[model samples]
Target: MGPSLAAPIEFSATDVNGKVHQLSEERGKWVFINIWATWCPPCRKELPELAAFARAHRNDPIRIWGLSVDTEQSPDEIALFAQSFDLSYPIFKVDPTSLRIFGNIPGIPTTFLINPSGEIVARHVGGVTGADLMRMIQRNQSNK
Candidate 1:
């Protein structure tokens, strides 16, 4: 967990389907923005966990989005990768070296947990399980 951000982070990226998704638009729900890459083993491993977590919270006030830093792969290839993992959450393609909104990535598989108000409350720097995510959400909720 990290200190609450002073201001809500804002950015928008187009998904594989070409639909633009803005972080600010998800203000009323908890949002998990996962930065990953197709070549990263840990990133590939966490997809199923994230997918399950998304499904489990489908009706809840939570949203999970994946950002793939694979510059070499085409949108169709990326979409296929998501399909291979059964990842139904929105996944976008981004430049790995330039993620200004979330600051320095430091590593792949980094995940940012944004509160309902859009403030970034937690950041995980490695692969995370669905249980780990749920625990973080519960812990943050209890803190409030």
Candidate 2:
């Protein structure tokens, strides 16, 4: 097998509610670290779908995190966006440096699927739906 890429699986970011979310604390569960922005249309379109995914998988060993990478937007604006949608998951406002773990973020709507062991299993660089999220979960759990 080819040498594996070690994505930085540890980082901390606060949610809109002022709760600090650390990837390490979510051990023994699946984690979805989604990097998105307020101005990205695709990202906007996928928010609710992702919220559905979060609710659907709330009881499962998985988590869906929506991190806003909008460097130009205010937290209040992002919070307004969250309120408008009544998002199911916490929306984290991260600085550009905090997202360095993902490496060379070219655009919005990037998602990383992490397994229970804290290993990144999938990295999607665009929008995703509830169906897409479930399939990835099932596929990865089956492998485990």
**Which candidate comes out best when scored by TM-score?**
1
Instruction: Please state the error at residue 6 of candidate 1 in Å.
Output: 2.1
- Residue lDDT tens for model 1, 16-94: 9899999889988989999999999999889989999999999999999999999899988999999999898999998
For residues 1-144, write the lDDT of model 2, one tens digit per residue. 311344336878888778887888888888888888888899989988987787777898778888898887777888889888778777888887777665556677888788877777777788999888878777788534
RMSD of each: 2.3, 2.7
Q: What TM-score does candidate 2 get on C-alpha atoms?
A: 0.87
Among all windows of 10 consecutive residues in model 1, the one with the lowest summed lDDT is 1-10
Give the TM-score comparing model 1 with the true structure, all chains together.
Answer: 0.92
TM-score of each: 0.92, 0.87
Model 2, stretches more than 4 Å misplaced?
Answer: 1-8, 142-144
